[model samples]
Target: MSRFKRGAHVDSRAGFRQEKEDCPVPYGLLKAARKSGQLKSIRAVLMYLGSVPHSVWRLNIDTPQEAQQNLSFGAADLTKLLLSSNKLQSLSEDVKLLPSLVVLDIHDNQLSSLPDSIRDLEQLQKLILSHNKLTQLPSGLWRLTNLRCLHLQQNLIEQIPQDSGQLVHLDDLDLSNNHLMDIPESLANLKNLVALNLSCNKLKSLPPAISEMKNLRMLDCSRNQIESIPPVLAQMESLEQLYLRHNKLRFLPELHCCKTLKELHCGNNQIEVLEADHLKHLSALSFLALRDNKVKNLPEEITLLQGLEHLDLTNNDISSLPCGLGTLPKLKSLALEGNPLRTIRRDLLTKGTGELLKYLRSRIQEEPKTAMTLPSQAKINVHAIKTLKTLDYSEMNKTHQDKSMTTNRGCCRKATKMEEILLGESFLSFDLCKYRMLAFIKIKRGLFRFP
Candidate 1:
């Protein structure tokens, strides 16, 4: 009963005729989709390749069937097509008709394979096909040299072709949550890549060549079976944040050259010991997460990270903390929960960082200072030794007086530098008897003279 829509002409045989601007090759695709009952639940909500001018076309296919049956893009060129979350089981090869496409995002679809003709979109720059059922990528995908961001996460993808090195312009590449066993070393050729995500995969180790990605700023290889990281990764000049959580690492590699690294997350591992040499070089580290590990103690060198703001040592075997930990000027959050601390009261830990730090400082102040006693043969200068006022030699054991006098002569006759010491506040003036005794026996040191 309703006359043909705006762009449609009445066709006696095919029932509906599209506008002349529509490509004939893609027109047959619509007819095939209609015949297969693919268009039964979806309205005529598709854009055929038109002229080469209108570049930004977004076909938001997530709408209900009541969506507009026909929408006008005004211009003809189709440069961006976003059909994300569509129930599209297959994409027609006629997609090649849109030669001007620069961004093609069909994420959240059921597409198992892409048409080889996808290579025809030479102008493509950003391609997102994440959350799909794709087991392998098409060879045509690797030839897109202009791509800057390629997201293929949350898919069943098992491998990436070596031809991926051709995307030298990629800045962000997310291949996380896939079945990838390992990455190709050729990925190092992406010298301009800034962020890379390889989480939740079946990878046991990473290619050492990954350290060659000079401009990579973020590298996430979490939730894998990686037992260790390539030591050369510490040489990446631009790397700032590294994530290796939920793995089987027995020890953290010594990152001696990662000067720009700021955040390191290596939780849930078998790391039992944190060596001072391996951790002290992260000079710029601000956030360090060592939770759920077998760590028995934290190295005192960890306090050398003067810029550190947060430290997580949860669920470890640490029984005592380094006293210097409370001296970090910028430390704001210190997490020591679930550790076997024997000295710190559990209630004091719950009192917040300010109170906990106050307690650590109180302990520092309460600690007894070890006295420094000079040996019997050491020389002493009576003038330099400020604490010596009087000493009682009359009460000395008569048997040892000769030995004591001989030892005291050697200790004072050649008076040298005296060690500064804390003196008791018992007396003020030097006793005359002490002066007399010092002049009498050459009991030469003030330490042996008796009052």
Candidate 2:
């Protein structure tokens, strides 16, 4: 006899065996097999048992009553559970039964707190609770050593537990849009953290220990009350992108050690100076944004950033720009709008970035070369005049020639008329007059002239 015939009973209402009904076997086929005695082998019994694990479950977008009732199901084999977008205000303590659970997504819910039993899930790796009314996290949350990603953004959370750094395996964390006043120094213990977002918070300052996160790659602290950045931030060699927009910083921190930094955003601040030391070591920088600041001038050293691609200095007190700005090779986007720039025309600036960069480059090529050439030519002319004075010449003619050369005009007519009486010897007077005529010619053309 088949296993279904020996141990399973047919439900008369559904006209099929209870066990085979839920299986994929057809009711008529099972009836025919029973009638012919064909279901007699162990291989026939294994065909009805499917090979799919019942470990994943989703109770999203369901009514609160329905979600609560589903929780009664056994949780021994559960590995992933998604309860997002529901009306759940509380999680049952029975969640601790799922010791094997690894992923729990409860975002977009009305959860204001989590059950203390949550820490019992030692295998939990990801916990998402964003867009909720959480004002604080449970202390037991710090015990989850295997947790890799935690997103608690868009919450009313005012403080983070100092022991949060215990989750050393955390690779991504987002705490933006909260009322956080400060961060815990212990966060530096998350040595494996890769990305961190703390934007739109009330943070007044950052912990100096933040530099301990040597493996961090991206950090966003924008829209906060931060007054300054810790100098040790330059020690984070893996840092690639940093955002400090809409803060109260008055000066840019020196980043001489951040050789791998690629992008920096410090817009909407009170920064007034951009000194050489501030930009000297960011050789790999590609984007720099300083819009809406009090900066008045750009240092000549800014030209040292050969890899810079975009420069934003909009709405500043800058009145002039260094001509070297036009020589950067990789510059593609240059924003200078809303500045008090006096040298460049407003109409030309309105034409766009391309025209502005082109104009700056043209200034470099148009620098007057004549200023460098004039001094050398002047020295040669002076030497030639000194040699001419050593030649034979009468005192009367020589004095007339010196006065004419000093006045930069030909007094030859006066000299020739004076020679009629001053030097009556015809041959001597003729040669002297001829030499004076040639000197006048040379002075007229500016080849050799006396002051």
Measured by TM-score, the strongest candidate is 1
TM-scores for all predictions = 0.68, 0.65
Question: Alpha-carbon error at 67 in model 1, in Å?
Answer: 26
For residue 155, model 2's alpha carbon misses the true position, in angstroms, by: 0.9
Error of 1 at 136 (Å): 0.3
TM-score of 1: 0.68
lDDT of 1: 0.71
lDDT of 1 by residue, 209-231 (tens): 99999899999999999998888
The candidate 2 region of ten consecutive residues with least summed lDDT is 370-379
RMSD of 1: 15.3
Per-residue accuracy of model 2 over 1-451 as CA lDDT, tens digit each: 5656475886668754455425533434333333342321222322334211111112111133323667532212446655666555777676776676678777776778888888888999999999888988888788989999999999999988888989999999999999999999999999999999999999999998999999998999999999899999889898889999999999997777788889999999999999887886787899999999999999867776888999999999999998879878899999988889999988988887788888988986666221111110011122223213222222223322333233234323333322121221111212344344233221113233358
| lDDT scores of the candidates, listed in order | 0.71, 0.71
Clashing pairs in 2: none
Tell me the deviation in Å of residue 313 in model 1. 1.3
User: TM-score of model 2 relative to the true fold?
Assistant: 0.65
